[model samples]
Target: MSTSDFVETSYCLVFSNDKLRANIDTLLDRKGWRKEWEEYQGKLYLTVTAPFDLLAEEAERVKLEKKLNTQANSMARFHFSKFTHYRGYKNKMTFFSPAEQARLIWSALEDTPYSKNDFGRGVLPKFNDQFPFCTAMKSAPAFGLEDSYPLHSPWGKRRFNSNVSFRLVNLDHAVRDYFGEEVAFYFVWMLFFAKWLLIPGVLGLALYLFRPEGVTVDNSPYIPLYSLCVPIWGVFFVKFWKRHMNAVAFEWNAHDFEEEEELRPEFWGEKRISPVTGKIEVFFPEWKRYTRYFVSFLVMLPMLGIALGAMCLSLNLNNYIRDEESPLYIGTLAVFAQPGGIFAGDSPYYGYLVPTIAHSVVISILNTVYRSIAFRSTNFENHRTVEEWEKSFIVKRVIFEAFDCYLALFYIAFYRFDVVALRNELVGLFWGDELRRVGVEVIMPLLTMMFQRKRTTRKMRAEKKASNEKPIELSQAVLDAPLEEYDSFDDYLEMVIQFGYITLFASAFPLCSIISVGFVLVETMTDSLKLLYLYRRPRSRRAGGIGVWYSVMYFMVIASILTNCFILGFSSEQLMQWMPNMFKHEGGDQQFKLGYGRYVVGMVFTLEHILILLALVIEHFIPSCPRSVTTEMARRKHLAKQWLAEHEADASQQKTVQKTEHVE
Candidate 1:
């Protein structure tokens, strides 16, 4: 929990061969090696001081308590490492090491603080023990070798090999092993660069170029070179990562999908009312009918939060804003965003910033947290299909996201002290009370809907069976169709832009947003109220899609840019005193001058930062999407299921003939 706990608790042990002990002593004498050595089973092993000893020991004890086999316990039993997966700063005092990942399961059996008995069954109750711990050494010799064996104990190799359970292996000799010595060297090098080179390197050059105390002025030559290559380093990292994912999918044969996408509970409690007529009426249960509506309502929650914050800002600005003469700025941060934006005082853009930032950050956190919760229990037994894999992703994350976003609006509404005369006690009483009820009442049903959406699919199959139409079994039908191909620019627009935007939460004014009254307020309330009485539970989309968070920055960049221009271009009564500082502190004339150091940072922040954001948005606007790999697999799987059914029927018929022959 604290730095002291991490440092004080010694976990690792060190031992070596009698011959090696002296060598090690000489090697590590300067490196702060403490504690004594021990001999076991005629082997001189150095019990190096490691943090993972406690984890490994605890994991083993839990395994014995659960009565789980050695293998299972080993996979689950674990401890953390001193080094971090990321770079540029000191490693966290505690973090996961691959060696300890396997022992984590056994740790669970011991009723450890981190143990969760109900992982896959509830939100994520099932824990799998198949992932190997092979990546402990980045420069693993066992990697890419058929007969190569691990040198460290089995636990030491669990980190990288854990992905081996996912079956992502690269056997190609043309490219070097991903974790080979050279690759490892590069990996460390890049991390060091990411931490130190990118941000600090750029800053150093700027400081040197625009030094208040003149040292050397060589900023111009390296400017383009630095700007260009930093991105190149980033690009190589991205490509390398893609290969990493592909390798995992290949090794595990996980590319094949397991579950069809569905609204599982949508057709629950269906009724056939028409007996005499050829057409039969099926009544959808309450939640099934309003699936889209419910999803749309949830989608609009952030907007509702925005509206709430805006109103409070407006009210505050109405009374507090004393400035006059608005500036002509570009986007969300113009005069409209201030306290007065909602009323007559400031521009309307003032109230939008905080909610925008909050929304983006919340979405990112929700995207990652629930996904990990879902991912915690994956193993060979449970990870048979893509749906199972995504189960953790959808169920765990959606619930948390619903609660977090729901509460955001609640906080703003509760704290907005717009009352003319407020008794301190009753200023804001019931901000998120209704949302808290909704979160409790509806979350379970929504989560259940994820696994049980087949209610409708089965209902439809039954109807087809009874009627003249041939029955289309859902298991066979869902994966039977292929995605339509894209054609021209019109098709691209139709498929990617309009189709993508409307169905997903696409922004109307990306460069400049203006969610005005009338529909916005109505939608906000409609969305909020809908959270209570949903017809169907919606599946989780890529809630933390790069598009959404990037848009926030895009919004901020535009806002900041507009704010800069407003201050620089216009002579506002309020900001004129501050605006003078952005440029060099001018003489009596009060104008910007060339050759000043202020130009270095102020120029880059206002000019380069804005351009970078805009360019990134433009690059992202090409409208790409995941390949329809899931669609293809579903179709193939449907055909496979149908084939299997035919085979089983034929086998049954053959058995009957054999029995008849025997009787004769």
Candidate 2:
């Protein structure tokens, strides 16, 4: 679809009351919003458009800001906003893409000021305040007014169809145009992640499949090799992703989009003269905010402790079941393995598998409960911006999620110092918990959609029979109304945790990367399916990059360095056994006391520092913007200068023409 068509046809607003409809219409007219009204099932629907004049004005404003900022050198004392002009700014007229148009329209709606006479002057009310309930007035009051949101276009659905081949090479434009940059960045990053997994996946698989015959876990040479490679892979993965993000961001006109952050409507504080803009605005004290954060941390620390305690309990229970020397294990076998017993010999339900299943269940349950607590705690911390709020929420949730997902594996690797058990734990978590997550995310949604369709069909048939009329086909809105909202946070979190598995413990389980690659490919199709058929169209949101998730991944990259080094140097028996004979024996003595341990620690220390330095070097040498992107940026700057010069000449000519006309 064309940019104009996508922008003008995608949005919808719904209201039911006649009086409220009139009020809404009045508001739309006053705001110069263009919309077509239609009535359906007792609801008044408005198919709204981003007004052409307003869009043009916005475009011009952006262009002018760009021009002024370009002229205002970086060394200037006064602060200037860096607004990225639309792609068409080189021409005299600028045109906004669908995503930009949608962003502008949403901003206009969100910034709609309430009447001082209707709402008190002291309280700043907004258009959203009219929803759910509206105060009565002489004209009309709008109640239960649904928020404006974008509709899933037919073109979008077709473009995002998962049934098509999984070649996602150039879908970034389509995704950005339809779902906006936030969702686009996610899909792009996901595809990029899957692509990057191929190198490590294949390498790990090769090492795992072709190990020497009769090689025990303690003597395999592949373990240290694979472990050494993974942390470097992780660091490169994050660095290269940063580069790719910049390239794609430049293409999508979002390279500097985050610089224009607006104050969040939910923010509340005492009014004061803002230092940034020198305007009267609400300001929250920084010290008070930090105090609140400290208090929230104190509260959540106990919860985290509880989570760790549960993990330890699960581990202990698993050991009890797995250990044949334990009385619990003997009793379990006695009950199940009795001659002619109901369970028979080695029954499918009775095995060491029970404890692993129980452990996964415990993790799932704790994750569910802690996610809610994390959200509430973050809200109590009272961040002032969406970015701050999201970063805080993500950090809080990820800490708990990482603990839930990896605490057992860490304990097994470091505390128990068991390589075989660590490998087993990785396998169990992958097949049991990880795949279960996929089923819940993808399969449950599919089943729910099928059920909804069946119920809708039955309802249609009953109506036809009652009225003695032909059956009516279901409309898009009706089909969509029953579906749930599609939020990407859970999907992002799940993938990041999976990433941790592959990178942090790749040596313990050589197949980790390849297994994750398979899951990621499946998720590609399933996520597309959810967007196209199983959920309501998500609201478009503007994002500069993957937001704070990149930071999360970078931290994971650093942690992976430490973890993998530890695994190779101390956790892996194979590597320790390979230590030099001199290092194994105490210096100037025959005793095998602290020599090996010290040597291993020294090696780990050296390896970690080298990797950390390598990461720093990569960060320095590999520019965030690729060469092509840098060239393109320079070209755009030149074009902006040309446009500004031409514009000035035209204005001067117009002034001169007016002067001559006055003289005549």
Candidate 3:
């Protein structure tokens, strides 16, 4: 059938209140739809069912048609809002108001869209909004009580109930439908990482169990196996994830939505008259934007050099302080404290501690400053959309942030691995120092959480008193306040670094994997609670893919491979002893080459290239889009074309019959 023939021409009037039912019935009887009226919900209902060629009163038909059209549009918009659960933006638009959020939910009957009958399933529930808090609002026995009641622990206030079963499939559907594809993409990405980590965790545990003891200076046979497994697994994981994401995108209808995505809300441009519509249109200056972007790189390069220099200085100083045997320790002690004779041993720990603190402080400061600069630079460039602006900023930020974050590992793997040369060149740059830093990183999160909790409790008490509101029944006043939203990118970055520490330096610290696994398990639950209840829902964003982070992960995997190779080459005294001719040296007893010879360099270079090539080959073989999705899409197109052809044929037959009846 033609579009008009199949289109819905009638609408159902649904009323929740008796007064609204009476008013609508009176209005319909006075104007039109008097005969079409029927009893619904034991009150009144009106249906406008006018055929295109009806010989009835034209004026009455026209009036009824207008009313139906208006109501239909209103219903469509209301149903759209229901499925989205998008409480309108707050005055500041920084956060959503709970009062406004509660008001936005539509009555069930009004939210059932007409398209649902012909297209697909009706709207899925906005589960993110409905879970935990919404359930509590409905079921809390003390909700209307005046007196305070200790219902749950302060830390556990926002926790989701374990008994409230939530399927991953439903959660994924709800996230994509309400929050948009970009947020859903990250949700899936997190799930993928959580699942993929099991592989490495299992392998690492097995290796640890079978690890050879007292094998100093000798490479553990597991080192080569680990080096091979990491990159291979990384490549396979990335490919598998891409295929899975493609299937999800197709299932969610996000693949087509991406093509139709409008310019971001933040976009602005000069006005220009459109010839076709005779309307003013916003036009961006592409030339100006490109020029600013090109100039930004020049400005950024010098700033990057300064930041790198500061990081290098801090790392070297940290290493210097940790070395007890270094002459620099005496110099450091003389400069910073009393004479070297009085406090010789105390200085090394202090020395290492001071630089470690300085390193963190300097990086934090630089990160904040550079982020501000990057944001401003992106704004100055005048990108036409938020996505464009963010993409540029992320590129600049990720590059510097990755270097700032990973340089310590770089020093350990490349510089500190050579025990003799490293001792000669820079004192105190030991594997032990690296291990100490890892422990500090792991402990920092717990310390930060404790501090934050104390501060928040004090703030909540003061706010509650100032508001002069009745004290709600809760274990703590902090429960009344909204929990802070944690950034997904930041969380992912931390985990990536932890993964790097485990994989990249596993030779130096086998227990790193175990430590990371423990942290990941705790983080998985905490993060879920934060998303489900603690944090305000994020604004919808559209993402084609998990932008740039894949690159970051891949880089770490490759770096891990190189790091393992380096450790095997230099740090393994047994390997060096076994292959004494790997390097050349001038005549000296037990003094081999300090650096690799042509043969050794060539072998290492060839190995790295081969592994990289192998990864690329594996990736090439793995199809990004699943075969099933492709086949299904093709079948849908074919069926749609056949249906259209058949519909046209039926319409033509009907026209011929109508003409013959007119002739008779």
Q: Name the candidate that leads on lDDT.
A: 2
Question: What lDDT tens digits, residue by residue, belong to model 1 across residues 1-664?
Answer: 2233222222222122253244334433433333334333343323223234344344344321111122221111111221121221143222323222223322222232222221222321122111111111111221211111111222322333333322112211101121122122222222222232234234434534464554322213332333323333333333333334333332222333232332211122444665677454444443543563355446545544553454334323333222333222223433444455542333454333333333434444443444443344222113333444444334334444434432332222223211111111111111122232234334654554443445546656676778979875442112111111111111111112211111111111111111111222232233222321222111111111121222322333333333323322221111223344544434433344465446534643565465445546644652232244345445545654554465468778899999999999
Which is the winner by lDDT between candidate 2 and candidate 3?
Answer: 2
Task: Estimate every model's Cα lDDT from 0 to 1.
Answer: 0.30, 0.67, 0.49
Best by TM-score: 2
Give the higher-TM-score candidate: 1 or 2: 2
* Comparing 1 and 3 on TM-score, the stronger one: 3
Clashing pairs in 3: 217-573, 217-574, 323-428
Misplaced by over 4 Å in model 2 are: 1-8, 13-20, 31-47, 50-54, 61-98, 111-114, 117-146, 159-165, 216-218, 273-280, 320-350, 453-478, 580-595, 651-664
Q: What TM-score would each prediction reach against the true structure?
A: 0.25, 0.80, 0.58
- State, as a TM-score between 0 and 1, how close model 1 is to the true structure: 0.25
Query: Across residues 1-664, which tens digit of lDDT does each residue of candidate 3 receive?
Result: 1333211223333222333344334433442231244332243333332222121123122211111122221111112112222223122121111211111211111122222122123221222122222221222222211111111122222222422234443444444444446666776776666677677667767666776686531245665555456656767777888888778866654454332222433345777887788766667878978899888878778778877677556544544334556432444433443334322325654444455455556665777788788887877787755567767887788777767755665665575554332222222222333343344333454465457666766665666688996543322223322234335665566566666665565455544455555555555545554554444344344465677777777777777667665655554342344466664434431334656556565766776777778877877887889999898667655654554465468778889999999999
